[model samples]
Target: MVLTVSDLAVARGGAPVLEGLSFSVAPGEALVLRGPNGIGKTTLLRTLAGLQPPIAGTVNFPEDTGAYASHADGIKAQLTVTENLAFWADVHGADLVDSVFEAFDLVDLRDRFAGTLSAGQKRRLGLARLGVIGRDVLFLDEPTVSLDGFSVKMFASWLRDTHLALGGIAVIATHIDLGLDAPELDLTPFKAAPDARGGSDEAFL
Candidate 1:
């Protein structure tokens, strides 16, 4: 499995949020996390990305898994769009190429300074980082939060197309549904643990 979760559980403020949750994903697939607010969707994604350790359980990745999480400020504010991408490319040890610019639709903005770009533009640039790297699995949390409808559609389309083109695994946690082309694992219940206590409050504590 490109990604695997076994008996995962998490707690915040001394209360368990997710328990006994397990799932797996392979290449050329996209998994979506759907849930109400404050239900641990982001927490699960963070755990899967290895940004947070689960209270109990295990997450396994392939030996060469390349991963990126949201809110990392992938772009260098002091640099132009191309410059920022080049920096990431260098970090990932990837060959800088025009395809990364074409993948994220940033060709026109390549010469523009990253700091002056809008939030949606910056997010798109961040997504473009994947194209520059050779990661087998990709993780994105709320990737479309600041995007307008047009940009959102563009990104969804791009994501679907890229999965097909590269045969990679993409896991995204977003409230706005992308209608992805791959199987989606809705994580709401796993996050909330609706059946965790079996309707009894006595065991919750």
Candidate 2:
């Protein structure tokens, strides 16, 4: 799968956040977004994932081939870990629930209620859904949040084994370095200037 973004512009609260950005990701490739907070990395990911419309430019990718994982995790609190994975597996017609559990070291927590899990555990469960869905293009936002060092390494290994190995494309927005040598886009150059409500923005001036 290939994802092509041409001169993309993204906004927040009716104000542009990122502008004149463009890139492409081929199958088996990963593109990392790097910048400080509030630089629109989240917005750019959301726009590419089709969760929000871009202010300008084009994002071209096959329909239904993309999956997005935000920082929120989006787990059903009352559901068991396996139950959550099952729901998505059913939805996406993917039958890798057990494998995903093993991938994230959740085999022991299969029957545990998501509500009872700690923050890092829930984050793992949230990310595990991506594996179950089996989408070709993944848009991830701060995917390493609340994870310990080992878990982070495990997550990176999974990305290497499953997604990239299968010729999938990934666009990740994160501050932590997962040690992947993927090409990076620093969003500071693309940040939108503050409007008249703020003082003259030297970056744009």
Candidate 3:
């Protein structure tokens, strides 16, 4: 599914976080959001995912949408990888087994417990959730954070390949290089004006 934002504004802690920010993601397109820490990168991704309400403007999402992956894995520590994926697939009504597991090289780790996995492993599992759910639009925040160099490269390859094969859009916010052909959108370029309280504000499409 395609996503479009226009004149979008969001406030957190009674302070303007994002304003006048505009960007769009067509099918099979990958858009990266980059900015310094605490610049509302996560907020913008969450807003695009429709998990956060905008104070002004609109967040447009396509009709056939499903699934979300936060910075955290969202998997139960005690559960096995197989169990976690089964639960997600059931919730999202996805049935492709080999494709999802092979994409992230998780086929062998399916029987391993999530708690035993390394930080990079957990991130891979979290990312794999996106494919299993068959979501039309993928919203990822700092997807490569905490990942080892090798794992990060692996994910970059998987993201580019899968995005092309499935014809879906991936919106990622990260400092690390994804090594993909995705376009980058620096949120700082679209700055917000400060309100009367000496706070900043901005929005987008």
List TM-scores for all candidates, in order. Answer: 0.85, 0.92, 0.89
TM-score of 3: 0.89
Give the per-residue lDDT digits (tens) of candidate 2, residues 95-136: 964678888989999999999999999999999988889899
Cα displacement (Å) at residue 132, model 2? 0.3
Cα lDDT tens digits, model 3, 120-177, are: 8888888888777877788888888778888888788777787545688888888888
lDDT of 2 at 134: 80
Query: Which window of 10 residues has the lowest lDDT sum in candidate 3?
Result: 196-205
- Per-model root-mean-square deviation over C-alphas: 5.1, 4.8, 3.7
Q: Candidate 2: worst 10 consecutive residues by lDDT?
A: 196-205
Q: Rate the local accuracy (lDDT) of all candidates.
A: 0.75, 0.86, 0.77
Model 3 bad stretches (over 4 Å): 64-66, 196-205
Candidate 1 C-alpha lDDT tens digits along 7-52 = 8886554456777788888777788877677777666776677765
- Return whichever of 1 and 2 wins on TM-score: 2
Q: Quick one: how many clashes does candidate 3 have?
A: 14
Query: Sorted on lDDT, highest at the top, how do the candidates line up?
Result: 2, 3, 1
Q: What is the lDDT of residue 47 in candidate 1?
A: 67
* Model 3 whole-model lDDT (C-alpha atoms): 0.77
